[model samples]
Target: MTITLYNTATRSKQPLEPIEDGKVSMYVCGPTVYDRAHIGNARAVVVFDMLYRLLRHEYGAESVTYVRNFTDVDDKINARAAEEGRPISEITEETTQWFLDDMAAIGALEPNEMPRATAYVPHMVKMIEGLIEKGHAYAAEGHVLFKVRSYADYGKLSGRSVDDMIAGARVEVAPYKEDPMDFVLWKPSDADTPGWDSPWGRGRPGWHIECSAMAYELLGERFDIHGGGNDLTFPHHENEIAQSKCAGHDFANIWMHNEMLQVEGKKMSKSLGNFFTVRDLLDQGVPGEVIRFVMLSTHYRKPMDWTEQKRVEAEKTLVGWYWMTEDAATGEVPAALIDALRSDLNVSKALMEMHLMAKNGDAAGLLSSMTLLGFPAVNQNLSPSLLEKVQRTNAAPDMLDSNSDLQLFQKKLESLRADALVSKDFSALDDLKGKLGAAGVEVRMTKEGVTLSPGPFFAIENLEVLK
Candidate 1:
């Protein structure tokens, strides 16, 4: 089956025919690494992750190359470092790790290449020098600016004219720029800021140029797909087009943009008090799988509303599915689900298909589809005892009760663990652990023995059958 995507550049849905047979390349704008990744940031990461998974499924996993860049050197990071009285490197390194941890928690696969802007400074300088040599860029007052007028299709991607952009867009009106539409390739940095020695002086690459130079160095001038949030459609992506094209590169073949995320039908803002980091939700006991599901419940191209209602519903649905498929080995993904995903990456429709599978008791199919959807069973690779300990800690209570019913359930879990150790098959043990989590009971399986206790969300009614 052919994969199709809604290309923001051409304004149409088109088949994803890779430029090279049996090979696919992708580049997505990554986080700035100034702070923790917000839910909005996770949406873009997960959206591209889904696409990467689908591409790897269509074309062999080894055939696909995905690159997501990190803007480690930026004004935001500089300000954060100054405010905290920390080294710029310290701030970037910590924040970059936070972003990776947060995204991994939400089940986003690490891209093949994560280029930090600072690492590619020399490449950026070389690209800027090439642009200057080609008359596409000019240096003024120790700053290098791309001549927007030099590229004829400057506003083609965002569907805006240069005149319209100058009038409507909040462009920087620097006296050094020949035109208001012209954007910086490199800018002089003060002694206090992170800077690199270049022909223009000790400076840093501008925001837009960092991506272009990094993408060129990693994925080359032409790649199959380029993606980011729609908010970047205008100046960020448009400038990338002007700079990359004027330097005689075809750049990205297809441009994909996921819609922005909102919280409870309103724009998420710190002022509005709805702003949330991915870590925020995690700390509130929202599982990473639940977050990923809620994000994909809506089509990628549509605005996603992260409401409490959606979160609760997604959690319930995932719990139910996890329980139903606990003992089933992953089977082949259903054709219908694949079809849904293939059609412009219609994740909503694909999820609906999974619901149908769950309705019909297609446990193996459901598990397989869920895995493809990035919801693999919890800790399937861990030892049965280790897996039980993890589920126990999820909503663990400080105290454990030695009631008769709890004792009997603990004995049964021990028996299951004993059989699993010999057979080296954990399906039955995993199934029981699923029930424990579903019933809100903390399950502890250690070298000494198994223990049962009521957890934070414990419901005795759900655990009575185990007694």
Candidate 2:
């Protein structure tokens, strides 16, 4: 099946037809480097990373070019620099490094190009000059403003009318702007703020222009995908669309936006005392894979509610899948999972199918499915002594006489199963089942008898003898 993504601009699922055969040029808006990345920010990174992985797996890895940018020259960084009494470049560099480190810890692949706004000042200036020459923008009071009325399709992407946007805008109408809805292309800077020599004066590019410049410079005017958080749908992405399209470039063909991440069922906020950074969660011993799984559990377009219980559940789920291939002598992954992932990156459904495979003791199928998910299985070396122990244990009758330690271990396993059954904890039950299988204790539930063997395969009639 051809991969289909729900485009926010059209509000429909459209088949992804690459601009070039087997090639995809995708760009995701990256973080403004002034503070540690919060979980909400990380969600966008993880979501896009999954898309990139799926695209690479389906197509050839060499065919995909992923560009995620860093807004190293922004008001936030300037404010942070002033507060610390440091150069804005220093602040941007420090925060950008932290952002990269945090994302790397979460297992996100680095983009093919990580262009910074600071590096693309000349591009921004040239674009602003083009807009001015075309009568799409004009300079007033040392600030360059885009003429919103000049672009008839200004609000097409966002579905916001100029009147409504003007009414909702927080900034008081500046005297320089002909229309309140008109946004800044560049703004003048004071002596203390970071600035570049521009035709409009020594000033920095506006927030929206940075992305337009970077995307156009890296991926040309048109690309396969431009993605980011749903919050950017408004003035941020809207402005980008206008700026790029008005410059006589096709801009991005497909726009994708991932939904927000909530904490304890509400929007994460410092005032609500539920704010969390990616670093904060990692410090609490949450595994990076577990965090990635929880973030991807929900569909990209849907909100993800993160809680301690949810995180623990994600970890348990990952451990179950990992344990299946831990002892396998072979490393071949199943093709079925790859087929599912190719069908629009349907990970939630794919994971459910994986659980079903585990339930039926399909180890090869399970391993194959995980490989398709971009997590390859590793070969775990069994020590000579451990292998000997396994062989000796298997040789005994029902592991009863294998080792003196077997009795205590069986008792512990039985207690866990009992507690799991009593509490109706299916997750705990499944985890215990996997643990027992990994340890060479096979359990069968039947009306005839509870037969315990030392391997996955055993005669059904053996239950009668145990009874």
C-alpha-based local distance difference test score of model 2: 0.76
Per-residue accuracy of model 2 over 1-467 as CA lDDT, tens digit each: 67888787888878999998889999899999999999999999988988898888778789999999999887878788888899887888888899998887666889999999989999999999999999999999999999988999878888888877767767568888888778899999999888999987999999999999999988997899999999999879999999998888898888999889899899899999999899898787776666777787777888889887667556545555555555654445455555555565667656656655665567777776665554545433222322333344433232122333334445555666677678987676577566655443566755453445433222122222222
TM-score of each: 0.82, 0.80
lDDT of 1: 0.84
- Per-candidate clashes come to 0, 2
Model 2 CA RMSD to the hidden true structure, in angstroms: 8.7
Span of 10 residues, lowest total lDDT, candidate 1: 394-403
Cα lDDT for residue 78, model 1?
A: 90
Mark the regions of model 2 whose C-alpha exceeds 4 Å error after superposition: 168-171, 329-336, 374-467
Q: What is the lDDT of residue 185 in candidate 1?
A: 92
Query: Candidate 1 residues 1-467, lDDT tens each?
Result: 89989999889999998999999999999989889999999999999999999999989899999999999988999999999999999998999999998888888889999989888999989999999999999999999999988888888998988898778758778999899878889999998998999998999999999888888888887989999999999789999988898888899999999999999999999999999999998888788887998899889999999988677656655665665676788899999999999999998888877766765668889889988988867555322332343355444321212244566788888999999999999999999898887765678878898877654234334565655
Best by TM-score: 1
